[model samples]
Target chain A: MIAVLGLVVGVVAGLLVRPEVPAAVEPYLPIAVVAALDAVFGGLRAMLDGIFDDKVFVVSFLSNVVVAALIVFLGDKLGVGAQLSTGVVVVLGIRIFSNAAAIRRHVFRA
Target chain B: MSDHDRTNGHRFRAELPAEVTAPPSAAEETPGERTPAALTGRQRLVKGLWPPRVTRAQLIVALLLFGLGFGLAVQVASNSDGDSALRGARQEDLVRILDELDDRTQRLEDEKQGLEKQRGELENSSDQAEEARKQTVEKERQLGVLAGTVAAQGPGITMTVQDTKGRVEADMLLDAVQELRAAGAEAIQVNGVRVVAGTFLTDSGDTVSVDGNKINAPYRFKVIGKPQDLEPALNIPGGVVQTLEKELATVTVERSSKIVVDALRAAERPDYARSSSR
Candidate 1:
């Protein structure tokens, strides 16, 4: 309940302020956002499975964003930036879809 | 019970050592209460990849999700703003813009038509000027022939003065030439020399010279004119024929339908004389 309240407050604050992202972080923002979405879906799935852990959720959320950005940075140095980004997006997208499907099943019992 | 569980079980065994392996449900329990040594490698991997139910982690996750939602809204707003340049305009402004565009198109069309009409008029005037130039050139050629500046051929008379003893002086021949000119001789050639307005006759030893070109008898004159008028002008009493006969020169005047005076003289260009410019 406290988490949900914090989420609502954070969203309202973000929309009202409309903070500008720095140029250096701009490239990583989109991938970070995708990783964040994957984390959110995974968390929702864990919650429905009666396995939700605040420590695990926070760790995964932070690691997911950092690792995804790191992989893209390394790919850029290796001159395979675009291809690696696509690979990450595809993997994350599949995880998101599966997690969402699991959450739907747990909620609707269909 | 399902193939999914069996596959997960195999993955767990392959990734985690037997001693570090624990029940998967350990992730749902209090994360702080469990010892790190009791947690399995597979459970640790799951904890790293998924969110836990702890208050602090959940709050952080929710905050991140809120940011994601805000970013999406911003992206949507910016995108729509880019395409909404004219969308914010009033109905009257849009109508006025359309009317202005129509007026511009109509003006351009009218300008094009006017230019086309001007081009047509210019073409017609140029064609008329070209025709006039051709006619002027033809008139100049005719005038050149009449002036004895060009060769001429037509029906006329050929007079031969047989002066065997060379009694015919240049003055008497000059008189005959003058008479032919008065009788409307279009072109005249005397002793192969073209007789123009500037021609002079002079006696040279035993022969007569026309324009400094000496000729031997019998002196032949090819005259381009009306044959009837030319023959009569020579045969009239006290004319060229009588004067030549009295000089003991046998003069024969023949009327032919075609006489060619193939002699040319350069037309003089007057430096000071010009046509009056109206």
Candidate 2:
């Protein structure tokens, strides 16, 4: 439930800062997914360590998502959505690799 | 942690740090001590990532997250039940607009051809039908006046847009005005009212009201700016006309030699959008 409550950190923040997007932004959906999953993985790690502090997790999750989104938005504003999304995938790709390694150890260790 | 483990009739060995590996059986055991494998922080990290089996904590967190996500989805879903209605309205508006554009575009083209013929006549022969001549001159005056009003500069530009079907919306108007402002327009007026942050949108089933004024066509707008600055405001890509070309709305812009935009009253605030910090 705590992890569940933690996900609101993104949704509420999303509605707060996410502008009413037009259909043109459909392509950036994947970047948003990566950012969300990154937050989830990071949150689960925090919970297991007995450090599931709401403020830290929520703020961290929100900022992480927003910063990624904002960069894309800025790129969109600057007419560079495709390039910015590519930039996002590069950083998120590295984070995904690191996070997957962590998840592997978490589940398989005896 | 153990150097060798026997599991399911197979022996497996691991290379681990001294703290992580179990001590030799000959070593004296400490009283009330944790297992040797528990000594390494890295092992704990590995264990947290992929335990051999699921833990109660993981189940609780997953269930909780799903429930919360569902509840939020439901809440937002209920509130936006107007999506269908909005879509319907938008479609209806679009159909009406296309028809109007078809008719108006043809009319404008015909008018342009007529004006051209009139010009050709003046060049070829001076004498023309007086009544036809007067009517053409009147239209020219209106267009000229409006163009001049947009060109003049004291404050801003007012663009009055309306649809015969009463379908022009505040959002549409807002978008156009925003574009104009973005194009360096100092200020703007729509339907004789000033554009300000507090400007609101209200619907009386047909016409959408702006700033509490029951404005209808012929939507006359006046602007105060250099003709050069204001004209470009209306021509940018994806600008005013594109946004507001809804089916039931007809937009006619006139720039007058001396356009008067009445000082407007403060508009009411919208309740739907709230401040982020608040």
Candidate 3:
């Protein structure tokens, strides 16, 4: 019961802590979407007993979202606002692969 | 070691039945049993950025990581916001500069139009002067032809007047020329030079001059008028000679017959009008 409570609260708070976006941030909204997917996948993996590699899930989800947002923000500053989204997707994809492996490990344990 | 490990939880669970393998329902638990407390959401988030474990060392590491990540997020957000504001300022500056350039270009176009108009006016005046020069050349050519044709004609009239007596003035010569022209002269000359509408006179050395050529006593002026009307008009009582001789008291007049003047010849000109007529 306690473990389940911790998971529910962690997931909910993660969802709610979304920082305010700016108009200059509009081009980066797609990166935000990828970050959202990373969190959703992490939560779903948790629910399904897909992988309980807590470290993997937290680091992957955090770095994917945060680094993606940072790259997009940096690209906007560098005047190549469109290309930052590519970096966002790339980092998100890397994090996704790492977490997916963890998911597979526990879920497909032979 | 055996004495300290005697009351452990593992030893207690080992004493329970196989029913313990199944999830423990509320009905299976003894009433008022103590349950483990759940960690708060803030505690879970603080620990999330760290290694997955629970110990004094791990907790300390988790707290450090949480501080680092939190500080990084706040700093990045603040700095990026400032950068965004600066970008907006640059865009505004660019737009303003473009507008100024547009305004300058518009003014330059207007100035160019005004200069073009002035240039057109100058060109028009130049073209007029060129046309006048061409007409003067044509007239000079016609006069050359006239001189050739009229060389054979003979017998003309002559009149003379002067300010040598210190009384006649430049107007006296102009008056004489006017009267000769009115008397139906075909051609006239003053001081051995052809006199036309462009003739001018000025005073020099106590005598009035014609076309800058001087004359002495009995200044010889010639005219080719029809003899009958030519002599009668001037010799009529109280006429031009009477008037001029009365004033200068040194003027003279003379007339003759068989005066000759000629027609100016012209070379053929291309009739572009015919080809362009239609």
Q: After superposition, how far is residue B73 of candidate 2 from its true place, in Å?
A: 8.2
| lDDT, residue B130, candidate 1 | 97
lDDT of 3 by residue, A1-110 (tens): 23333444444443445355455655454566567455545543342331224454445556656766788787768876556566667766775665455344433421
Candidate 2 chain B worst ten-residue window by lDDT = B1-10
Best by TM-score: 1
Give DockQ per model, in order.
0.11, 0.04, 0.06
Query: Which digits, one per residue and each the tens of the lDDT, describe model 3 over residues B151-242?
Result: 32456576666545676667776777777778886577665656654568888866767767775555667677666677776777777777
Per-residue alpha-carbon lDDT of candidate 2 for residues B1-278, written as tens digits (9 for 90 to 100): 11111112111112222222234312434454655333333444445456444545555445444433443443344336576334322333567778999999999999999999999988666444666688898876544433333222354444556666766666666666666656665445666656555567566566657768766655555556665667667755666765566455555555545555554443335579777896
lDDT, model 2, position B39: 32
Task: Report the backbone clash tally of model 3.
Answer: 3
Q: State candidate 1's TM-score.
A: 0.47
Higher-TM-score candidate of 1 and 2? 1
Q: Write the per-residue lDDT of candidate 1 for residues B170-229, one digit (tens) a residue.
A: 998999999999999988998789998778999999999999999989999999899999
Report every candidate's CA lDDT.
0.74, 0.53, 0.54
Model 3, which residues run further than 4 Å from truth? A1-110, B1-152, B162-164, B248-252, B259-278
iRMS of each prediction in angstroms? 10.1, 11.9, 14.6
Candidate that scores best on lDDT: 1
